[model samples]
Target: MMRPRRLPPCLAAAILTATAVAVLLLSASSPGGALLASRQSPPPPARPEWGPGRPPSFAYWISGTRNDSRRALRLLRAVYHPRNRYLLHLDAAADAAEREAMAEAVRGEPAWREFRNVDVVGEAYAVDRTGSSALAAALHGAAVLLKVGAHWDWLVTLSAADYPLVTQDDLLYAFSSVPRDLNFIDHTSDLGWKEHERFEKLIVDPSLYMDRNTEPFPGTGTRPMPDAFKIFTGSPWVILSRNFTEHCVYGLDNLPRKLLMYFANTAYSVEAYFQTLICNSSDFRNTTVNGDLRYFVWDDPPGLDPLVLNESHFQNMVNSSTAFARRFEEDAPVLKKIDDELLNGSSVQLVPGIWCSNLSKEQGRMDVESCLKWGDINTVRPGHSGEKLWRYISTISQTRGCS
Candidate 1:
């Protein structure tokens, strides 16, 4: 389930196609060229919550391409915590100017400067998610985070369409009780329809060698499925443990690297790589929880994309124990509701957490602009929803162990 982090396969293509038009207007767009003139902007003012790093952290890999910069920033605010590490990537399809703009926005944020945890990939390559390149992009991000050395316990992969369902405090609190080695991945050995459609086909990703992104091309013949390893498939989204991430990034054993080469020619290998590796490796296969920890609504035929969420899904979204939900429109009203009710976010400020040292009454709600002074980052105070998540994890975690 902890597949590579990249934009959706089809979406990346569409974004790359628009690069030509975007470049034409780059000079005229302030948002696109704003950061080019100034590269060393000061960091956000220091807040009390994270004065000198006293808490466990998360390393988030959030990626998008082209026009997705705005959505990426919004997601950053929603999940931003001084104690966590963030790496943002806009694929090669986007113009360098556009990527610079995104980085500029990050540089302008005082909070990011103070913590020095948020980073953007200055150089990127086209990543076609349908092929194995998506896995490459994800591994690249993990390697970058590992090099950053921020002491993160987990790696969470997310896209622009994804949104957090709980505050960072609630999420950290709920996960604190569970063992850090436990990876939440939903996997089944039964390949079902994908056996022939995905596993049997040999495809080549043009992004691997070409400067532009393109659809994968089918090879002449089909290959027999392998008995050397059992194939498992499930939701591509995953919450992976730090140790497993290291194994994938550094490849302590030959299996992880060997599987990467085998999957390079397989279609939609992102859906297969991690699933097969964990199930096939004795060291990690038993550490899985058999859940991706995400809430998604599938269509009847279950096409390539999940159903786009709207207002009607609001109640269900909040009620779910999952930490995140997906396939939302860029500015869906449901997102506003999630911000208002769950995250306490607004147009100007992000979701407030225990790290926010001060709060004031404004418009009938609490306003937390910044951490300003100081607060304990190590401690977490879970909200009401955290209790439900705790019970669910405690109950299901016992029964599900990579079975």
Candidate 2:
């Protein structure tokens, strides 16, 4: 693919630097240590392979707010791969200067240049997780990812606070044997305590129409919760299939459209929109596996946000068997541990994969032969933990989805 020059997302400013660019090219002795030398070496020539022969590719929509550009880049590198697609967005909360710098940084990466699969949204949109505006932003990202390419099978949404528990290779290998149509979203129809506060009550998100942030307003009147369609709600984080995403974005389904309008007046609609829409549509309900493929710890009573993960959460995070986890503090030391122990990633270099060949550890750079060459993009070679993930998925797969 011809490389496309685009701006970096809000969190990748250092990605634009020539020095930092070469730093990633160089190999490191340890994950957190200084770069040592180039370790790239030429390999015997072979004809390039493509399509199902390689690992499955993902389309990632990584979103964050102001002052989150660096953390976004770190997460990006942690999950980066040549075959997958990425779309980054910084909400209106970030100023124009931060947004532009992020875009420029993405353009500076050699691997991103060779594959041309990464992009940052230059335009700004208002978003507040406290209301429906966050869902609007997510859907907007899905629209942009669709416009970027047609090759990806799934769409995963992540925040700057989230980090991977496994490498791209580990994640791909674990998912390779599974059906592509299934979505990993934790959902439930049993609203429990949320029925009165979330379903019956109504609120307005001024971010939907206002140029600046405004608190949500309670509706003057309350409406009985609808039985027209079963209401479902879950974690906002999701790994959605491209087919289902298309259903939400372009399908001629009235339920999806109706739910969007209904949830516009609901608080924290990002958590409810897809859950309600997917379960209501008989076509998609069976396809749901009811897992978000992420690990998170909620405060008791479950406040507006989850606990911010730190070093103390490291061991549990690794043992969770989830692909990712969230609410991590920026530049947490635990992240460095993950890069070293799990992903085999360096401080700034992307998590290595089969796609990356000819790495040089001594000189700390990829030689002229270091450009990402194509391999079996659809196949996967799972690691030790990858097998465990497959087993966990199998168990989750057997349980009938939430009623």
Candidate 3:
């Protein structure tokens, strides 16, 4: 008998890549898979309405480190809307129990359970937020969102320390008027001091190769900035257009992947990677809005991190007309105030919106509402806060072909 012909190496690799992407897109994440298997799975959610007539949906990537499960969950509740999709990732610092507990907590929520749009990443990995590891984690998240969330207009990334200043209704309503292809990222090509300190330095991120991430250290000498493409730096937080995120993850164009390799050894790569990538790509360059849509107050000359928000900042936070703010202590009194006043919610309840108003609507005896179904999920009822966000967004016009 003639020997069977072997498949070409390139063809085999392409097949494997296609298979992996399909698997990621089709399945619920690891722990969630187990949860689904343990009980009867909820029916797949109806496809969200897209286009100018309907409000845009978001894909949120919420990351936390160590014992931040509770805070991350709190953030999720504050930002929750049935219309949106969420992916939660707790780094290796968080124990497996914590990860499992978070997954369980998600399952406990009636709306989350009913809608089944939320998931916990089944695996654990270390990430130093200052290194290429963080950028990798972010790219990983965008890829997962692209695969799992069949359609969403934008990808919003937040940390455990970050909190929403406006409700999802407000967010969706504000974005409704904006172009679907626009990207909300703060970027400036004026590298200034960062040219030497961040871009020119050669650093090795242990997290890239090691099981647990260690501190990233610099080499003896620095290299010159690249002449191939200009570099832009800005806030690490961004609301990226789904189209741009697809470019980053799928590498349909080579620019995204090329920048990814160059930034792998640079410090605080997350701060510059997306900014650089978006500003460099001719296709996406004109789509920029030059703002992350988050509120933050740095120190006088600025420090490594933004100042921690407190009760003092509450009034200003409200007046800032921004959608989100950062660096809050876990369960701060300010948070409760935000819930009660701005969000029209409590710690126990999700921020009420078009999908569901009563997460715990129950009578004394047996007349309890089924959390599985609520009002029209396609519509939104925006409050005064929504108006402010829309106005703010309108002011930040599109980029003039990337500085």
Clashing pairs in 3: none
Candidate 1 accuracy as TM-score = 0.85
- TM-scores of all predicted structures: 0.85, 0.84, 0.88
Which portions of model 3 show Cα errors greater than 4 Å?
1-47, 359-373, 398-400
Candidate 1 segments whose C-alpha is farther than 4 A from its true place: 1-55, 359-371
- Compared with the true structure, model 2 gives a TM-score of 0.84
Query: Which candidate gets the maximum lDDT versus the true structure?
Result: 3
lDDT by residue (365-396, candidate 2, tens digit) is: 54232333444434455677788888888778
Please give the lDDT score for candidate 1.
Answer: 0.72
Candidate 3, after superposition: displacement of residue 252 in Å? 2.6
lDDT against the true structure, per candidate, is: 0.72, 0.72, 0.78
Candidate 3, residues 1-403, lDDT tens digits: the string is: 1111211112112222422442112112333434433344444545567666888899999999889999988988889887789988887788878888888888766567666678777567668888888887777777667766776889999999999999898999998888888998988988888999998888888776665757888877989889998899999999999888877776566676678778888999999988999888888889998888898989999999999999999999999999999889998999988987898776666777767654442436543323444666788888899998898888885444577
**How far does residue 186 in candidate 2 sit from its true spot (Å)?**
0.5
* TM-score of candidate 3 to 2 decimals: 0.88
Clashes of each: 6, 34, 0
lDDT winner, 1 or 3:
3
User: Counting only residues 3 or more apart in sequence or on different chains, how many pairs clash (N, Cα, C under 3 Å) in candidate 1?
Assistant: 6
